[model samples]
Target: MLQTLKLLLPALIPSWRFFDWIAPSPRIEIKVNNDWQEFRPRPDHVSFPTMMKRMVWNPYVNENLFLASCAERLVDNPADQHSYEQILNRILADINDQKVTSLQFRLAFIHREGNALKKDIRYVSKIHDVSGAQA
Candidate 1:
């Protein structure tokens, strides 16, 4: 069933972002001391990351049909802004409570260009300062 849904999702939704035509990847980066590293759920961690991604991509984040909405701004929706902020705060607080010095989010996309085809981190969003953040 899941596989069928995944295969048919594109046809049901023609929007590129909705279909994830260009893979948009997100990673949480945490700073410890002076160095930064990727943050991953513990082996025991539950479905938090999946929930976060879903919340980020929910349609309430944007409704401006005029502007092309990028996957990076998933949390900028007006309707779900407050809820998204709460979820974000909880994640940040959890990291900080675990003694992480700082936190940020990085979003990247994979695509092909004129002559060469490659997969790499093409762009990263602005660094979010979650150092000593309570929320």
Candidate 2:
């Protein structure tokens, strides 16, 4: 068990950055061996090399009734050599480097209106868009 934990430490640990060289960065790089010479190249040279979307929580959208967040944007092209997983890891590393863990607290909403009335609110959680049509 100890040996397994030690081996898996790198992947599980949160990567952080430092002004000094003591703390090394988590570098992820991927190489594809698609021989261009052996195979015929596609007509569209402008094809995206990598694409990914990040879904993160939005503090601005938080309310006493609901919580909401959205995808900021879609990254169409990233490093050509990096795979999707590699790019994800790189992004995670950057986020970890910038973010600092802190304590969590609960906030209550206090409102006064309508004869000083309070109503219990219930929100419906929709998982996804289940349209009949294909994506």
Candidate 3:
């Protein structure tokens, strides 16, 4: 497995910055207690690209592939109302594990228009109450 190799020989792999030039910069956000926070990986605190590249030994191995895939669907058709309850449920469980309440999920994209890059919020999930059954 890739995880096993990461532990045995960590120095062989290159950093995320090496492939940043070829990735699309996408913003992923999560809401806890009604507060929106950007989701960034720990330690290095690196935020991964929306569209991922398949590399055998990439440093961005810990990227949220689930979120990235879901985000792509949202970007492809912003108006499509898809039930991401499964994903939301997992996130809710994580929040509960952390002893937090209130939950929301959002994904944004940067659209290029001429020389300007515009931020477009493509997806925003409803605020779900963690106390009761998932909405």
Candidate 4:
């Protein structure tokens, strides 16, 4: 019994090392016209009622989280075709304006430096046409 308890102790207790090597996460940005913008910009603020409602039901928020995961996967493996296509399709769907012909996207690593946040561009995709065509 003593040996069994000792063997299970490490598994039962959480380790601090889990938080020690946190790395920067990736963000997806799309360039329209000449300006770059977040693919899914977070709302500046949410009312208490809306926040409470989101706790139970929030498809948009869930989808955005999935997209962020895809961006992270893309950053880890630039050649990941599924993630690349998923991001491209999602961005294309969001751009409703027919006048917008082409757009570019890039992956940025966002990290904190002391009190300020910094962004480092890691990959910039070729400009793709909005009409379900890759350029």
Candidate 5:
């Protein structure tokens, strides 16, 4: 998936800033593939990075979040898997019917002392702009 993304990123993204975890308020990462390329657009085969138990994501993260995140990115941006994960999760919330579930941004309250899972949510609607977060 990472290799595919690098190949397809340039066309789908009008302009993008790479994201990083260090060195700045919002870190920017460089694309692994060379600068300009076109996406092949194969939603069926795109794969996600394995979720780690000690990762920063919520406690109840599951395959739904993983797969939906991919589908969600196809609609918005098909190139960046990281961006797809973040944006796709939010949009996936909206995809569910209104009567069944409300679009509400899910939150986890981790205590400073223990970092335990205090809450679990399946929906999120308060997010106004998920512009920069690339997973």
Candidate 6:
């Protein structure tokens, strides 16, 4: 009975170990007009009301989170074509400019080193023609 109770105790109690080990996360960057930018850039400043609203309903934020998950998958499996295609489709959908004819994408691992953040480029895809490609 004591052994059974000990086994069940852990199940009943919650372990709030959220940050046991901090590691780098993968980020998707798209090259647009000779400049590379984050696929989904977060706003620098969000108001208290806006933060509360986003916590309740924010499709864009959710989509970005999904994309981040896909990026992590890509990092784990470099030959993951499904995740690669999903990221490409997302980038194509976001860029609706007529002037941009070609673009490239790369996966970057972002991590905090000491007090500074650093980005290390992992994979750089060949330039893709946007004119003939379908998202």
Best by TM-score: 6
Candidate 5, which ten residues in sequence have the lowest lDDT sum?
23-32
Q: After superposition, how far is residue 73 of candidate 1 from its true place, in Å?
A: 1.4
The residue-by-residue lDDT of candidate 4 on 1-135, one tens digit each, is: 998999799888957586476578778899988899888888898899998999999999888878888888888898988888888888887886545778889989889999999999988888886655433
Over 44-102, each residue of candidate 2 has an lDDT whose tens digit, in order, gives 53323421111254332232112111100112232222333333333233334333232
Q: Please provide, for model 3 over 28-88, each residue's C-alpha lDDT reduced to its tens digit, 9 standing for 90 to 100.
A: 7887666777764445543455224434445444446656666776667765455365456
Q: Sort all candidates by lDDT, best to worst.
A: 6, 4, 3, 1, 5, 2
lDDT by residue (1-135, candidate 1, tens digit) is: 998899798898766565546543443334456565554433455377866885767443233121123323443443445443543554575575565545554323345677666545433334566654643
lDDT values, one for every candidate? 0.48, 0.27, 0.63, 0.83, 0.36, 0.84
Comparing 3 with 5 on lDDT, the higher-scoring candidate is 3
What global local distance difference test value does model 4 have?
A: 0.83
Pairwise TM-score winner, candidates 2 and 3: 3
Cα TM-score per model: 0.35, 0.15, 0.52, 0.76, 0.20, 0.77
Return the TM-score for candidate 6, rounded to 2 decimals: 0.77
Error at 1, model 6, angstroms: 40
Ranking by TM-score: 6, 4, 3, 1, 5, 2
Give the Cα-based TM-score of candidate 4 against the true structure: 0.76
Candidate 6, number of clashes: 0
